[model samples]
Target chain A: MNTAALHKNESTKPAPATVNQYTFTPRVDIRETENGYNLEVEMPGVDKDGIDVNLEDGVLTILGRVQPDNQDGFEKAYAEYEVGNYERQFQISEIIDEEQIEASVKNGILTLELPKHAAAKPKRIEVKVG
Target chain B: MYSLERHLFNQLSGLNSLINGLPGGTTFAAPEGRSRRDEFPRLNIWKNDNAVVLTAEVPGVDPADIDLNITSDKIGISGELPSRNRAEGEAYQRLERSSGKFQRQVDLPFRIDTEKVSAECRNGVLKVRLQRAEADKPRKIAVKAA
Candidate 1:
């Protein structure tokens, strides 16, 4: 990290707001399985009620909100981390069984299981010999 | 004697504040191309009269995998985030979330009482509280009616 650049930037911006509100892209891991696909999104500090997942028009959208830390009369003397919201979207193809998708949130991680359509599943063909 | 030493330290800190007052002087040094916000498990620090609090966002990491160590002048946090993709005949299509070992150490301006420190992890956020050392705590001297 370049300490020199930071020192230079500090003078340019005004003091940040007492309660910072911003949006950040959540990190996601998408894997393809024989049965379907699994998506894992890392969204720390977000409770189940704070997250909203929606799929519309072949698009999957995820929104997450993080509540500020509860401190009893404690002022923010120093800060390096900012509490922000999370949003991400993905386009779903026809092979995905959107109607059968399942989602769950645990330990700030969101997992979505998207099963494949019956027609999309691979089937082995058997050949008969005379 | 203690007051005199504290006065000298105050002067030095005042000078540092003056220098840091310069434009862009206060920003935390970040990687040349990366912003400080880009770091995994970003930290937030707050200090009150009695204690200092530190919090970090570390999702998807098992609590058992986290390791934290605290001393009078510094605190260290380290942990490993296991890969979540485990399925037979599976392959990753897109992976942006980090996996593996991560560690961060922060230095405190004043000593802390290790015995009074406490940590809690919930909903992927780790909160640590460090009580100020006896000598570093502020106290009011009662005035006698003379």
Candidate 2:
């Protein structure tokens, strides 16, 4: 099966909000199995309560919010990456069982399991010899 | 006795503040064609008069695999990220996450008290707090009228 044809990366602009924090596209790894698809998203500094996964109209959106570190008495000495929230969306095909999808986060990585519908699963047939 | 060290620290602080005061904060030096692979596990540092706190983004890396080496004024971090395990029928559709060994070293503006340093890893981010060495701190001098 051509997996790329099944999933399309949608470049949807984030909704304008009152917050001034920048939004970054988190890196991801997608894997296809016999039963379902697995998605791993990297969102550092984001805890479990800070993530939101939503599926609507065949589009799956993931948002990870990171609270800016308090800089009270400390001065910023150096930085290599900007602190911000994460947002990404993907257009999922009909083969994905959106209702059965499961999402979990650990160690700053979010794993999403998109199970395939029973009808979409491959069927095995046995041949008999006369 | 600590005038030279204080002067050097002030100069470094001024330069760092200038760079960090930009609209988008400090960015990679290269103008274009730069990738995250160039500097795996990017870092952000904050410091006060007595201590410095450093945070690094290292998602999907286990805490046991991370290694830290600290000295009076420098710290080195090295770690290996394990690759995802795949079964027989599983295949990758999109593999943007890189897994391999990475190492980085940073120099602190003030001497560190190795004994007072502490490190912790939570939710894929590593936070290291290093306290300034006692001997390196500026001491007030009393004046006596002759």
Per-candidate TM-score against the hidden true structure: 0.76, 0.79
The alpha-carbon deviation from the true structure for residue A99 of candidate 1, after best TM-score superposition, in angstroms, is 2.0
lDDT, residue B92, model 1: 62
lDDT of 2 by residue, A6-96 (tens): 1112223443373666566667777778897889988888888999999877767788887566657889898776667777766676778
CA lDDT scores, all candidates in order: 0.69, 0.72
> What does fnat come to for each candidate?
0.58, 0.56
- Scored against the true structure, residue A90 in model 2 reaches a CA lDDT of 69
Q: What is candidate 1's CA lDDT for residue B27?
A: 30
Runs of candidate 1 with Cα error greater than 4 angstroms are A1-20, A127-130, B1-34, B84-88, B142-146
Chain A accuracy of model 2 expressed as TM-score: 0.84
In the range B53-135, model 2's lDDT, one tens digit per residue, is: 99888888988899999999998999999868989967665666768899999999899899998999888889899998999
lDDT of 1 at B11: 56
Grade the docking of candidate 1.
Answer: acceptable
Alpha carbon lDDT of residue A38, candidate 1? Answer: 83
Clash numbers, per candidate: 10, 0
Candidate 1 C-alpha lDDT tens digits along B18-89: 011111222332324335655666777788887888888888888778899899989889999885646666
